[model samples]
Target: MAVPSARLALLLCLMIPATVASSRSLRKSPANASRPTTFFEVDRPLRRSSGRCSTLLLSASFGSTFNKPPATNAYSPPRCLVKAGGRASAISLAVLEWRAACRGAQLDRVFGVWLGGAELLRGSTAAPPPNGIIWSVSKDVTKYASLLAAAGKPTFTVYLGNLVNTTLTGVYHANVTLHLYLRRTPPTKPPPATAPADLVVPVSRALPLDGGLWFPIQSAADVASKSVALPSNAYRAVLELYVSFHQDDELWYKNQPGYQNGPFREVTARVDGVLAGSVCPFPVIYPGGIYPLLWRPIAPIGSFNLPTYDIELTPFLGKLLDGKAHELAFAVTNAVGVWYVGANLHLWLDPGGTATTAGLVSYVAPAAKTTSSKSADPVDTHYHATANRLVSATGWVKSSYGNITTNSTRTFALVYLLTFETLDLTIVADTGVVATDGAGGVMYSAQTHGNFPLGWVYQQNSLTVTHGLEETTVAAGRWSSAPPYRSLRTTQSSLVEDEEGGGKSWGVRQTYRYNATDGCYFRNVTSSNYSVVSDHSNELCVKGAASVGVGAVTAALPTVNLP
Candidate 1:
């Protein structure tokens, strides 16, 4: 049957008029082919020429040619041209790739990539090829594709900084490639115009910490107060916070005795005194260093090169758009040192969507408390003989608009029980959500846990949801160790839908494991999205460790006080 169908199709093609076929072939020729094209290429040098200078101020600047290095200059890619009869949908996708090289040097610098004056990405120079390797990065810039295509010309810049200013001899170069996908046929409708967003306010500087006691810094207070107003038609809001610890800050106490690894401090973001989100930084050493030697990794990269916290401000969009003032605050509880922090608020106005504003009907901020007990100790021990600490936080959030309401409660706990041979660290978090529209409602529950030991960490997460007539549950666990550093992760999920007089169920389970010693990994998956079940497994190998980087560390010194 397949052969006959193929022959029939070929016969139909042969029956076409020669003129028609010739015209089609010409249109499909390489020169006329409508495919993805390189929009622009940019390369910039990092070092000065005349003579080797120990230190040169590498700041954010803008420029055109790549000949001379500028203190700070922005690069603008060529404007994207939409051909005649071409619509936004004609451009299927766009991507930007960045590549750089560094010579004989100590990689201990930080680089910031900016788009339209907003910091889009930042990372340390530690991971680029040691001395002979080329570093390359790629990202999907499709979200900004339409804007770029319509704009006359937009500027993009990369900022480089040597925090330590080590006297290393090396020349650094950066290159950027923009790829755009074009369609052969234009779409029926043109893309919508890009909406303007409020200017991002700088809340605080990346200040240094002395590592003494917990301090209060009102980085951003009343950001959306009467001074900043949201458009009347805005329907949604979001709060994005970028947080990072100085690499040197982490290295300062890396080898210190009695030091527990990872982000130990609790950082919280609040809107109008309502808890938005909280993060306890946990350091995980990448295989290479802070920047992975392998430029591209499987996991998604963050803008801060560190962990980032984001929260949906939809519930508060109403109040903010109400022509009133609102406050945005950040609090670092139990922080012993300084950490970098930045905040941005984004609002979305869709006249076609449900015309509604977000408002916090009720909320209970999370209360965090810490208690510790220790045995009498002098310099005799490494300050780890007998130590115990427990930290916990609990809170609830309730938001409403029109007749819809969402309520959620969250609780987090971290425990550290230490001994001479080992330090037992445990973290647990639980959250439950209920959204109601009149009597009908959806409910969700989740729990996560983490345990850390010498050169190793383990994590577990589970989620359950009840929506309409469907119920779903997902459970996952991951274990990672650095002794011979490796990782093993597993996930099991099930969904059941109640229909008529019976329920239909689907289940899926997957496992992935990687061994750094042998540079090998294994994956297995079993799924039953329908009535039938299926299973598959694969074993693969790679060049080196899955990821390369140093583990996260605290800035606090060993404690000698008892609580």
Candidate 2:
């Protein structure tokens, strides 16, 4: 069953462990001193770790494990080394820094990092050239203090499945370090700025942590889920999901499924048996997509650090707070082996309440509706498709603070039109999509506005994921293309994240052109062999649409984004 929501296509984005017996051994690739480390990814700004601090080497020489499939390396998170009435209690913040390098020559590989049982990072290794390539990434981990502060020493692990045969000899190496910033004064309640969720529950397969907890979905019928028992005092919840498409679903843009025009895919989340929400993922082009050479120094945008999506589940907390295990499941309908999906639930507890009373007011969500059309010529074929979905839910909870009501509304509008030139073996995929998500009656008011593929906007007003879920109120949509090309392709892209006084918005503005001698792609549209692509933002930008109307379709990029 296909999911009913269409939200992600250009900016949807993680990974989780395993133990398998295999003799396949890989020699580590030697680092090249001459090759300059190039390539970077987009991420939320990093916070300076000041005050008494602690650091731990999370993963070392990961290249050795890359060749080991379903096998993961594990380390227990040590108590913040600095002693001050107990380091965990004095801890004020945490951050993760990673460095990787590769030499010789090899295909790019995908990897993930897990802290405790929650997924922390999802990335693709840049394919190294003969000499080699190197890169680094830094992330803020203050949001996961609960996991790090656990006294049991939750396990930290990584899963990087790779290949190293005679034909592909490049080996990738990575080292990760965790930094803990602590307070110097007497132990105090964490400052509001450093406060995170009270609890974080991993929605993943139970332990063994083998190969690392990430489950795989071979097809649309395969739904990956977990059952969790919540605290009666929990008043709010937010589900953060990470997704990556491999195999048949990787190039979903060009997929010709059943009688559907273009391609269709959506991610859906369910609570207990009732559907909660869904989204259309952003078509992130990996570094190896469409002639990998083009991304030698600068990888495709969002390829290195795939962005994660947030689904507000506070409305469903009404039935969940009754105190029994509830099923939290995810499904990628229209997928083909395998789409990897993982998630973490951030929960907020009433400061002084032992239990809360709640009830679901109303709910409405239907299967997505889609239509298609096709035109055929003696040597060419063209396909056009349109999709729309809307979901609205309302609920209320009574806590020590009294009764509070929360309501939510989400909408997705998209149109995909493509052309297949058989003689030239060329394919053109253009996407014009817009989505809006919102939640009300929470501690903070937040919103996200924009479209997908080329440019979009995401803004959050609260630092605590459990209380303030971003309500994306998009007034416009975006358009991007991936068409087969010949030679000489130039791509540009840039991302901006700005914040002030607790109001945060990830202003993602990117634009690029892929022109080849073959005249196979348009100046405004992209040129690819199926995968999605993007470029720097300051250089160019297609006039984006202010809003996506129902059943709206446009033939050109200029029309997709209106002034």
Candidate 3:
């Protein structure tokens, strides 16, 4: 069954315990941390605390639990630390446990957290586990510490929704704990002389559809600030985009054999109508007992966390920081269904700094595009399908600050190949009957089924400029499912290099391969000293090699107005 409305019921609860219990064992913590931390716990059933630091819990229940029909719930913390003034040292969001109810199966849910209407984090619920042990997931939210602390009566919301329909009724439990650590002494280097201002725009509530399927959704907003003129004398600027997708169980056209539905979807961001960067969405899967064991060892135990996509829009700051209203828009590509999105522009201004003189020099739209072809047998019986998709973009920026003038360009390209053949078959059965004193009978039946052989290959190459330097990254992945399409095997690899703007450069390359049969296993290889292979028994094994004087740096570099 497929869910028609595709909405889930969310229950918000606020919990404040006098003594917080630490679930640190469930996740790994970053090094270099002090003691004395504050914890806020959010769980099922609404609870209020007289304590100053309160916790909010978001829980989702479906089907039978909605005795009175479900509605959205909003919560606000009594006080936020960021508003207290001193700079924040660290912040993290730790998910203690996310487990599905006993009766629920075929689960597909999306979880999201928002502060003051701005999205902070979002992810998908993991498929139910066979053993029933709950799993934990964590993320570093240090970058958004300021936003969380400064929120005064801000709207904090958690949303949960189903992507597909299921027959069972159950509750989806989520426990999220927030950890905040503030600096007691301010003896270190003083915080930046000035902080960045946020300019936000509300995009579409639902992602738009294209070509009968959900294509990429795009929205643009004009930049404005109530406190100050837009982008006036800025040293640096960055744009943050919070994107969420509402996917259905029928992500791919099941009727179309050999076509992948969601695994390879990609999203890209742009500012001032110029290309910034692109990212591939991680596929979320909920496996049943019949699913291959190989994935069990390598996959996330009981949770599928959605990742927040962040792209550096600093390169376009030259044009954006002109002290004038500018348009900022984000575009998502290769997506299937409705998705939500929001944008925030952060600008760091220099004290006693001159207005920005950098501007767009020449721009070339990405040659990125997708094409497909299909062939039929001479007998007009069966058909074969093939598709080629190219993802590419290029941009040029030139800045004249003081007396130095530098020009730079960023280019990226990704190629995807898909090929598959569909099997054709026909069957007939007898079914008909009758009988009486001395009579007879008859019967008839007909049936048909098809099997598809499917394969997919993808490669990505990108060049980016950071702190006046150029960095290039390349990644590739390939996978194929055997005929009848019951399982999958995949191989993926990536390489990253930093150009020193000199004759020599350093980089690392890694490759991974996974097999479904033989109880699930993996082999991994890493680049090292031109030759030495390291062997291990891990699910993914690694081998190493290195290279010197491979090539010269060719990416153009840019000069900026700020340090």
Error of 1 at 262 (Å): 11
User: Comparing 1 and 3 by TM-score, which wins?
Assistant: 1
Q: Report every candidate's CA lDDT.
A: 0.36, 0.54, 0.32
Query: Candidate 2 at residue 537, lDDT?
Result: 30
Best by lDDT: 2
**2 or 3, greater by TM-score:** 2
lDDT of 2 at 156: 69
Q: Model 3 has how many clashing residue pairs?
A: 13
Judge candidate 2 against the unseen true structure and give its global Cα lDDT, from 0 to 1. 0.54
At residue 132, what lDDT does model 1 achieve? 34
Which should have the higher lDDT, number 2 or number 3?
2
What are the root-mean-square deviations of the candidates from the true structure over C-alphas? 22.5, 15.4, 23.1
- Tens-place lDDT per residue, model 1, 438-480, is 5544222122223222111111111111001111112211111
Per-residue lDDT, model 1, residue 421, is 22
Output candidate 3 Cα RMSD.
23.1
Q: Candidates sorted by lDDT, descending order?
A: 2, 1, 3
